[model samples]
Target: MLGAGSLRQQWPPAGKLHGATARGAGRGEPVVDRELSIERPDGSRIDVLLNITPLRDHAGGIAGAVNIVQDITARKRVEDELRASEQRFRTLANTVPVLIWQNDEDARNVFVNQYYLDFTGKTFEDVMGVRWHELVHPDDAPAYIADYMDAVRTRRPWRNLDRLLRRDGQWRWFDNYAQPLFAPDGSYAGHVGASLDITDAVLAEQALKETDRRKDEFLAVLAHELRNPLAPISNAVHLLRHPDGRRRADRLVEMLGRQVRQMIKLVDDLLEISRITRDKIELHRQPLLLADIVHGAVETSRPLIDQQHHHLEVRLPEEPLTLNADSVRLTQVLANLLNNAAKYTDQGGTIDLEARRDGTEVEIAVRDNGIGIPAGNLPAVFDMFTQAHRAAGRGQGGLGIGLAMVRSLVQMHGGTVEAKSAGAGSGSEFVVRLPLAEPPDEAHDGTAAGAGAAPLAGQRILVVDDNQDAADTLAMLLDADGAQARAVYDGPSALAALPALRPHTVLLDLGMPDMDGLEVARRIRADPAWSGVRIVALTGWGQESDRERTRGAGFDFHLTKPVDLTVLHAWLGTRH
Candidate 1:
C-alpha cells in the first residue's frame, strides 16, 4: 500500500500540525493528515482529508507512507451551524432588559443573565447559586421564603410579591414572578423568574384615599355649623307672634326678621361658594338698570345701617346706566357689599356709597370710615371663610362668607371687586368695576317712576310667632296700616284658630320643631276645606333648590324672611 511520492508530499504537510499531532509526529506513530477547506485558482472551495500512515517491514518504524484523500465539506458545514447557535443565545441573554434568572427548589439562584448581574451589581463568582433571601428585604425575606415554600409544595407557579433590597443598597418594590421548570418525567428541575418595578402605582393609590378622607371631614363640620341657628330662629319667629304677648311684639318681629334674613344670606353665600368652586353658575342675563338694582339693595340694607348707627350716604348719577346683567344677582352683589360695610364699621361711622362711570367701565364703591382691613389679610379677603384677624382688639360675630360671594358674583358679571384700606382703624373701601353697556339710540326716561307708598294698607291679618314682642309689633305695624291684625304663639294654635280667624293667607315658617312649616303646609293643603287658601313659604333656607323643593310641596309662593310688607300686601291682594 505504499506510494512513495504521494506519501512524501502528504507526510510533510501533515507534520506541520500543532499540539498532540506535533508530538505524535515526533514519535514513530502514524500521522493522520486531515485536510481543511482551501481556495482554488477558480475561486471555488473544496475540502479534502489526507491520511498518512507509517510504513514498516516488521516493527513500527518511520518510513515513506501512502496518503488517502476524501471530501469532507458536509461535516464542516454542520460544525459551523453549532457555533452560530451558541453565539445567538449569548447575545440574547446579555442584551435583554428583563431580569432573567433561574433558581432551584431551595431558592438558590443557579443562572442569571448579564442584565440581572448588572442590576444587582454582582459578579458571577459572587452571585451564582447564592440564596435569593440574601438579596431580599430583611423584614420581607422570611415571609417570601414561607410563601415560596408553600408554592413549591403545591407545585404552583410563582406569582407577585413586593421585595426590597438589591446588592446596590437601594430599596425597590418589585413584582416577582416565576414559572416552574419540569423534566420530561414531570420531575422538578428549577424555576425562572422576572422582577418588574411598581412603586409609583402603590403610592398614588394611597394619596387618593387620603384626599377623599379630608373632603368628608370638611363637609361634616360645615353642615353642623350651618344648622345650629336655623331651628331657634324658626321657633323664635313662631313664639314672637303669640296671642297674649308683650305690647311691643311688632318691634320684636322686625328684629327677628332681620336676624332670619342674616342667616339666609349666610347660607346662600355658602352654597354660592360651593357652586362657584364646582363651576356651576348659570346666568340669566338681561338688559337691566344698574341704578335701580343698587337703589333697591341700599334701601334693604337701611335697617341694618340704622341699627349699627352708621351714616349712609348714597350718590347715584342722575342718568340711568343700563347694562346686560342678571338683575337678581346684581342686587345680591350690592347687598353683600353694603352688608359688609355696615358689619365692619364702628358705631356712628360714616359709609359712602357712590356709582360713577369711567369711559367703558362703571365703578360702584362702598367706602366706610371704620375698622379697616390689614395689609396681610387683603389678599385673602375673597377666599371662602377667610376672616381678617381682629386689629389688636375687635368683636367677632360673622362667618366671613360675604366678600367671597361678592367677588364670585362680580366676576360672573365679567367684573372685578378690589378692597383698599390705608390700614387697620383707618377704614376700608371696596370698588366694583364692571363693563359699561352701549347706549340705546331710543332714549327712555324714569320720570314716571311712582312715589314710595305708605308701609302697607290691607285687610286685617294674623301674625303668629313664638316671641311675644315680635308678634305684637308685627300686629301693631299691620294695625297702623289700617289693617286689623292679631298675633299667635305657635303653629298648632294658629291652625286651631284658623277656622275662627278665617285669615286670607298663611305665612308659614319652615324650620318649626313641633310643627314645621312644611308639615303645616302639607296639612293645610290636605284639607279640601282650605283649598282656596294661600300658603307662602317664609323661612331662612333661601337656596334655589330649597325654594324649588318648597314650591313642589304645595306652597303658593316661597319668600325669604325679612318680608317687605308692601310685597306681602301685593301678594295677599292678588290671592284674596
Candidate 2:
C-alpha cells in the first residue's frame, strides 16, 4: 500500500495515469479513471471513465481494456425537461385565437408563432425584420410604427387599433394589446402583443346604422306618396259642397272630405315621425312673437274647439315677448296641444293658455281639464305610431307623431317642452319653454311680421316636371294668375329653352331620370347666361331637412307635391 502523501508527490500526470490504470485493470474488474475536462479548477467537468475486460485474457496472458461509460445522467434529464417545456410553449401559442407576436423596438419581427404564420400565409424567412411592415395596410403602417415607438420610449403598454393585410389582399381591423418587457434596470427589452380581430364588430355596427336609415327612408317615401293625393281630394270636396249642391250631395261631400283629411293627417304624422327618427328635421328659426304664435294656433284649432264646446281662456303679457323660433312649426306645436285638449275634454271642460318670462326663457303653458295621461304611457306618447288609445274609427285619437315633432322642433330652437297630469280625467298641462331675445330698443321691423300676400301677376315662370298633368296644371294655374308660364321635362331641355324664354322663376321637380332637379339648378346657377333666375324646388320629398338641403343646393324655395294654392300665391308674391 502506498501512503497518500507519497502517492501525490511521486504520481504521473493525470492523463497518463488515467490511461495506465484503465489498461492494467484485469478482466471483469471495475476500474475508475478521473480526468478534468475544464481548465478552471473551480468550475470543471468530471469525465468518469469505466473499464471493461473480456471474460478470457488475451492470447498472450494480457487482459483487454474497455472505456465502458461516461455517466451523463443528470445532464440528459435536464435536456429532456427543457425540450418538453419548449414544446408546451409552442402548443399553447398555436391554440389561442389571438395572434402572439414579439418584436424589437424598431418594430422588426423577432419571433412569430405558427398561428400567425397560418393567418398571414407567410414563412418565417419572409416575415422577419422590415418585411413585417408589408403585412400591414399601407395607410396604417406609419401610424403603427409611430405608436409602437412611442410605447417603447415610454416603457408603457402598446395598445392601438391597426389594419393588417391578410394573404387574400384584404385588410382587417386588429386591436393590438401589448406590454413592454423590461430588464431589472427598467430598460425596454422588447414588445409582446396579443392582436384580436375587431373588423366584424365594427362592420356589424355600421350595417345596423345603415339598415336603420334605409327603414326610415322607406317609411318617409311611403307616407309622402300616399298623402300627396289626399290634399287635392280634400280641396275638391270642399269646393263641391257649395250652395249649388243638394243637401244629400253636400252631406256626402262633407263625409268624404273629413275621411280624406283624417287619412292625410295620419300619413303626415307618419312622415314627420320618420323624418325625426332619421335626424332629418330642420327648424327654420326667425324672430317670432309668442302672442302671434298662440293666436294663430288657437284660430287654426277653432273648429275643433267649437265642436267640443270647450271653454278656452288665453292670457298674454301686455308687452310683446319676442323669441327665436320657427313660427310655422311653433304654430303646429300649439295647435297640436289645443287639439288634444279639445279631444280629451268633456263638452264643458275648461282650457287655459298662459305665457310668462322665466329668466332668459319664455314659458308658454296649455292647461286643460281633460282626460289625463297614464303614468306608463307618458314616456311612450312621443314614440312613433304608439298612441294611448289605438282606435281605427275614432277621430279623438291620432297616429302618434305630433308630440314627437313638437319636441324636436322645440329642441332645434334651444327649448324644451314637457307634459304633466295628476291622473286620467283629472286634467293635463303642457309647458313650452323657449329662449327669448331681449326686446331691442329699436321699434321692431314689421317687414317680416307682415309679409304681403303673394301676388303671382305678370311674371315669367318655367315649370319643369316629368308628369305631364302636373306641369300642365301648374302652368295653367300660373297663367290664370297673369304670369307667362312655360313647361319642359328635363335639365337639358330646360337649359336649351332658358336662352329663348328667359324666365325669371323656374319650378324644378326632383327624382327625374334625365338629370335631376339639383343638377338643373346647378347648371342654371353656374351659367353666366342666366344669373337672375330664382329656382324653386317642387317635389314629393317633404321632410324639413330635405327642404334645407334643397335650399342649400341653391333653390330659393322648396315645396312638397300637391302644392297649396294659398302658399303658392304667397310665395309668388314674394319672388323678386
Candidate 3:
C-alpha cells in the first residue's frame, strides 16, 4: 500500500536489491520470487517475497526496473505455532511415568518417548520399524504379535498380559494396552500403547492359588487320617461287646488304646499347629543335658520304630553338651524326625540318629535308608500340611504336620532345620541346628524324675466335668492310684459336695452347662475355708489366653486333655 518512494526508503542502502534490479534491467532478464524482510514506518518487520523485472525503451535498451512484494507474515506465524505445539507434546509424553509410543499409518513406530527408551535401554534407531517385538520374551512373542496384528487389522483397542525381556536379561510380566489412532478423515493410523510391570502382582496371585490348592488337599488328608483310627476303634468296641470278648479282652483293650492314642495325636497336632500359627505357643525353657533329651526322644519314638521293624542306631559326641530349651518341645522335635524316618523306611531299614557339637551350636541329624524325598520337593518339605511322599503311597496315615511342627518349634528356639536328599530312593537326612548353652549350676538330667513318686494315698481329690464318662474314668484312675477321688457331673453338684468332701485338690472342667468353671473357681477362691484347696483346670481349652483366664479365676494349674498321665501324676504329687 506504500508509495514507491516509501518502499525505496525501506530498502537497505547496502542491500542486494538495487544491484539485482540493475543487473536484471541491463541484461533484459527478470529476477523473481526473492524472499526479503521489510520494515514499515512504525519499525515493525514483515516477511515478504520480492520480484524484479527489466523494462526496455523503444530502442531495446535497459531503462528501469519494476518490483512487486508479497507479505507472508501470517504464514510464518502459523509455522512457528505448529513447531511450538509439537515441542509441548513431546515434553509431556517423555515426562510421564509410563511408556508412550506413536506409529505411522503403516504400523511402523515413528516415535517413542524417553520412558520407553530408558525402559528398553535402546536408542531410537534400534527400536523402530519392526524391531521392537524382539524385546518380548520368546515364549510370549508369537501371541503378542498375533494380538497386535489383529488389533491393527480391525482398528480396535488391544490388551494383553505377556512377559517382556528387560535390559538386565530378566523376563518380567507386563500388562500392555493400546488404543488405535485415526486421522480426521477416519482413515487408519497406528496405535499408541503403554506397558505396566505386573510381575509382583502375578506372583502373589500364583502363591494364593497354590495355598488354596494345598488347603483343599489338607482337608482331604485330614478326613482320611481321622477315619483310619476310627475304623479300628469301632471294631474293637464291637468285639468287646461280643459274648466271647472276655477271652480276647487284653488284645482288644490294647488295640483300643493304640487307636485312641492315634486319634489323640492327630487332634493334638491340629491344635498345636493352630496355636503356633497364631503365635500363642509358649516355651518353658530350662538347662538340660543333650543325652537326657536324646533318651527321652528315643523313648517316645520306640513304639513306632519297633512297629516298623526298623534298625535304629544312636550316636552322640564325647564332650558334654547342654541346651537352654523347652525339654518337652525339643524332645518332640527329635521324636517327630525319628517317627518320620521310621514311617518312610521299608521294614528292617537302617535309621541313624546322630548328635555332635558344631562350634557354639549342636547339630542333630536323623537319617534313613528309606524312600528319599524328590529333589524338587526338598525346599518345601517343612511347609505346613505338605506331604512330599504322599503321591508315592508311603505317607503312612499322617496329617502331614509333623515336619512343619518340628521346623516351627526349632525356629522358636532360635534354631534352623533343613531337609536334604539325593533325589527319591537315594535316602534322606534331616538336620537340626540349635544354639548351645552353658551348663547350669543345677541341671535337671532326669526325663521322668517325678514319675515314680510316692502314690497319693489318703489324698482327698475331687473331679468335676460335664462329660459323665470323662469324669468317671478320671475319678476311677485317681482312686486306683490310692486317692479318695469322687466324680461330680456339674458345677452345682461340685459346689454342693465341696463342704462335705473337703478335698485337698479339685480337678475342674472349664466348660459346664449350668455354671462354668470360672465362676465356680471365683466362688471357691472367695471362701477362706477353701483357700487351702488346690484347684486345677482340666479342660480342652489350653491356649495361652485360656491359661490366663484360668489364672485370673484363681486356679492353681491349667492342663489340656487328654492329659499326659505323667504330667497329671506330677501335679498330684505336689498336693501329696
Candidate 4:
C-alpha cells in the first residue's frame, strides 16, 4: 500500500522539532537524512526517510532542531524481493544433478553449487574465491583453461569432453558446457557452467568406429589378395596360347594350374569366412586315424614346401592315434596351417609337424623357422581377416582368412587352436588339439589317401567350358593320355555335340554364361541316347553348397578346378 499519512504526525516531539527549527533560523547547518522502518496501527510495516537539521544563532549556539520525514517503503520492498529471488536461485542450482559453477567479470568465483563442491570434496568456504581449474585433471587442465578463457573472451557458448578429478581421487570423464552471462544493461557479468558424465557413451562410440574401420580394411585386403593370383592366371593363359608354348607348354601349364588352385582356395576361404562368422558351417563327424589327416595335410602343402626348398621333418606317435572329425574339413584345417608355415618361412628353413597323444586329446603342432609373428599380434592372429606381419619386400598371396577358418572349424569340432611366437624373426608355432576317439571295431577308410591314375585307351571324352583355354587344354591333356577328346565353348555347343560325338564322359564347367552346366546336364540326362554318358562338374566354387547343387543336377562326380590331373584321369578310368 502507498504511504497515506502526513510527516507532522510521524515527527518526534513538537517542542523538540520547533526548537531545532528555531536554532537554525539564523544559521545554515548541514542536513542529515536517514531511512527507518516503523509499524503502523494495523500491524503493517512502512519505511520512511528522516531529514534532520540543526539551527544556530549568529553567535553559533544551537537554538532548535528541524526534522523532515519522507515515506520510502516501496524501495525497501523491491530490495527484499531481489534478495529472496537470489536465495531461491541458489537452492535450485544446488539441487541439480550436474556440476555447476559461475565466475564473475574478472574470472573470480561467484558461486559453485553443492554438487560441484561434493565432487571436489571441498566446503563452500574452501573454494569460495578460488579458480575451478584446481579440480580439473592434470593432463587436461591446460587445454580446459585455454578453452574456458577463449569462450569468455568471445562471449560464446562452449562445450568439451574431458576428465575431472573426482572426490574419490580418480579421474572420470564428463561433457561440460558453459554460456556467457550478462547483466540487464548488457555489461559482462560471468559464465554459467554445467557438466554431465558421459564416459560410457563415448567409449561405446569409439568401439563402434574402430569395428567399422577394421571391416573396411578387411575388404580392401581381401580384394587385393584375390586379384593378385588372377593376374598371373590370366597371363599364364595368354602365354599358353603363344607360338612358343610348344616348347614351354609344360612349364606354362604347371604355373597356370598352380595359380588356378590358389584362386580356388582363396574363393573357398572367402565363402568359409562368411559361414564361420554366421555359425552356419557344419562338421561331418566320424572316427578317423590322426596320422591319416596329418599325412593328407602334409601332402597338400608339400608343393609349397618343395618350392621353398624347406627341410621338413614330421614326427608322429608310433601308435595309431584316433580322433573323431569331419575328414574333409579336418584335412582343410591342417593343410591351411601347413601352407601358412611354408609361406612365412624363408627358403631352406627347417619346418616341423609333430603329433602326440596327451590324455584324452591329440596335439598336432606345425612349427617353422622363419619370420615369426609379432608378440602383440599373436592374440588376434586367429581373428577373421587378421594376418601375420607382412615384410617390406615379401608379398605373400592370401586373403588372411585361413587361420580364422582353422580356429572356427577346430572349435566346431570341440577342439581348440593356439599360436605361439618368440618374436618377429624367431620363428612360430601353431598347435591344434582335438578330442580323441575311443577304439573302434574297424579302421578308417583309405579314400582320403593319394593314388595314381590307370590308363584308359580309346575312350571318348568331351570338355565344355566358357573359357576356351581351359577347355582346350583339358581336352589336349586327355587326348595325350590315349583318349579321344573334343573341346566345346559353352553348354549349348556341348549339348549340340553329344548326339554326333557320343562321348563316354562330359567334363562340364558349371559357371557357363548361357545354358549353365546344370541345365545342360539335366537335358543330357533326360535323353535316352546318352544313357551311358557320365557327367563331371568342374567349377571354381567348392563350397559344400556348390557340391550339393551339382549333385542334385545329375552330376556323377563333382570336381573343383584346377583339378589334379591324376584325380581327373582316375575318375575317367573308372567311368570307362
**Candidate 3 C-alpha error for residue 270, in Å:** 0.9
Worst-scoring 10-residue span by lDDT in model 3:
1-10
State the lDDT of candidate 2 residue by residue for 152-177, as single tens digits.
78878878888888778779899889
Per-residue accuracy of model 1 over 136-223 as CA lDDT, tens digit each: 7888888888887787776689876665575668877778888888889999877878777666777787767865764564465456
TM-score of each: 0.39, 0.45, 0.68, 0.55
Question: Model 2's lDDT to the true fold?
Answer: 0.74
* CA-only RMSD, every prediction: 17.4, 17.7, 10.2, 14.8
Model 2 root-mean-square deviation: 17.7
Top-TM-score structure, candidate number: 3
Q: Rate the local accuracy (lDDT) of all candidates.
A: 0.73, 0.74, 0.85, 0.81
lDDT by residue (tens digit), candidate 4, 1-576: 222222333344444343232222233454445676778899997897766765555776655556567778888889899999999988888898788888876567878899888888989898877787777888898988898888888888889878988889878799998889999999989888889978789889988897787789778887887788788888887887888867887887888787878788778778778888977665555557888998898898899999999998999999998776777899999999888989998999999999999899999999999899888889888977666665434448776788988998999989999999999889999999999987633432223221123154668899999999999998888877777899999988998998888899999999889699999999998998888899999999887789789888899887888977756764665445
Off by over 4 Å in 4: 1-140, 163-173, 183-189, 198-201, 204-216, 240-248, 315-324, 354-364, 433-576
> 206 in model 4: Cα distance from truth in Å?
4.0
Q: Is candidate 1 or candidate 2 better by lDDT?
A: 2
Residue 396 in model 4: lDDT: 83
Q: What ranges in model 2 sit over 4 Å off?
A: 1-247, 279-282, 389-395, 438-576
The candidate, 1 or 3, that scores higher on TM-score is 3
